[model samples]
Target: MSDIRPGGPVFAPEEVETPPKEVSKSSKPASLWTDAWRDLRRRPIFIASCCIIAVLVVMAIWPSLFSSIDPFNARTCELATARQLPSAGHPFGRDNLGCDLYARTIYGAANSLVIGISTSVFAAIIGGLLGLIAGFFGGATDTVASRITEIFFAIPSILGALLIGSTFRGSGLGIWLVVISLTLLGWPMTFRIMRAAVITAKSQDFVIAARALGAGSARIMFRHLLPNALAPVIVVATINLGGFIAAEAALSYLGVGVQPPEISWGLMIADAQRRFLEAPLPLIFPAVFLSVTVLAFIMLGDAVRDALDPKLR
Candidate 1:
């Protein structure tokens, strides 16, 4: 092709001018939480789990919103309606004691969640601190702390709870007993996680830089190491929260957890287990609630774990 503008002085290719290429701007990389949240927003599993958890949380916080029946009131129990199946007025039907099974299930959510969450918090704090201290120091302190952790880890949670419950025979141990047992048994896992994380983080360039900058040990540990070391702990705690709830149910069923007067899914199952042949709804309703709740948490934890770990993502 020729530049046809009649024979005006045609410019050679070498003399022609061209536009310059545009330079691209660089942006800062997203932080861990930002990236995790972005990934979580796009995943249907995360969304579904979060929605399920939100409804359960609301039910736990305000049972009246979902169910008008008061399970706590002894007067509400009708001998005539005992062991009844799902009906028009009562969707979940009546328990062995004739109390509305739906109402009791609703109320039980709060207790189970409390036990699980509180135990997780307590265990994480206690274990995380000990781990931080041991990992940061990495000497005799590490050896002693590690030995202690190992000792505690050796004791199975259920067995320990049973031992403690038997020691107090006849004297009822309330919610606190279960909380204490779970916390005691659960911390070792958190301790191991935090300790490993801190060990890895303490040797990183950021930690060395902080130390070189004259930051104190306490400052370096809490301000630097702890934050970096929290990812694994958070993941473990989220999963453990669900385990604790299931454990609480198991313990209560075995007569070692929250006793009479306190309502829990485990206790409900225990109550209905004896006569489950006569009426299965009482056992099934609470069992279903517990299973669904545990599943939701586990799902949430798995989603979080995948988001946090780039390899998994």
Candidate 2:
């Protein structure tokens, strides 16, 4: 006891490390779509594509917002003003008939986007519902649906459209005819994808649990099954939407799509083809717009697909 020479305490409180609180098991996990949205936000491709698509959608809804030139005003043309090349005042040049190529091209976007989006949505809804019913119930329903989808798959959509377009006689209804024709053929692919998705989703543990809880078929399908099965369908629908727009152009070039004065890119391209050697800008401009629009949709679809797919993640 007499050996404590420094008059200081030898021991200090030992530093104690606190353990981290464990995550509670009762907390809900992030859903697939939630994770997908988070992943999409980090992707540059998704962002760029979304921007491009948004601009295009705005252009489609209100083309006058982009260009002040009247697309359908043929009286603005003169013999001397026809087939002029691109310049400062009239960028994108004048068409064979002297209409403003720039304005016409901008306006044409509306028709393409409307038909594409409308057709795909219609096909997806009708086909998805049928596929869901077939896949969920199985047996005779499945057999019939499978047969119908296969039959449609055997026929090329363009060929079917050509045949149907030729048979249908109408002046101003060419665009509607093309939409109808695409819907008829477009549904099969959507149906096949949806049927597969539904079959997989219906067998999941959550669906079984819902069944055990005595949920009816309609409730289980709408509340549980449809949400899970929608990702692939959405991707397919998005990708197919671009194809439908391109198809509208093709049909128009063939003289069966949106008629004169309606202002479609395909119609513009068709008019410029003959005079391509003299004024290539008119053709080039519309083609470029169409390419960019379709590419944007496809890229958007691909980004969405990658984000939604758990395997990819």
10 residues in a row with least lDDT, candidate 1: 165-174
Candidate 1 TM-score over all chains jointly: 0.90
TM-score of each: 0.90, 0.90
lDDT per residue for candidate 1 within 1-313, as digits (tens), equals 5575887666566666788977667756788888999999998988998999999899999999999888889998999989988899899999888898999999999999999899989999999999999988999999999999999988988999778765674665578778888898889999889999999888899989998999999999989998888888888998998999999999989988877788999999999999999999899989999999999989998999999999998
The Cα local distance difference test for each model comes to 0.90, 0.88
What lDDT tens digits, residue by residue, belong to model 2 across residues 1-313? Answer: 3344598556656789999899999888899888999999999999998999899889988888988887777676656889987778788888898888888888999899889998999999988998889989999999998998899999999888888887884745757888898899899888988899999999899999999999999998889989989999999999999999999889888887888869888888898899899888889999999999999999999999999998997
Look at candidate 2 and give me any clashing residue pairs.
none
Which of the numbered candidates is closest to the native, going by highest lDDT? 1
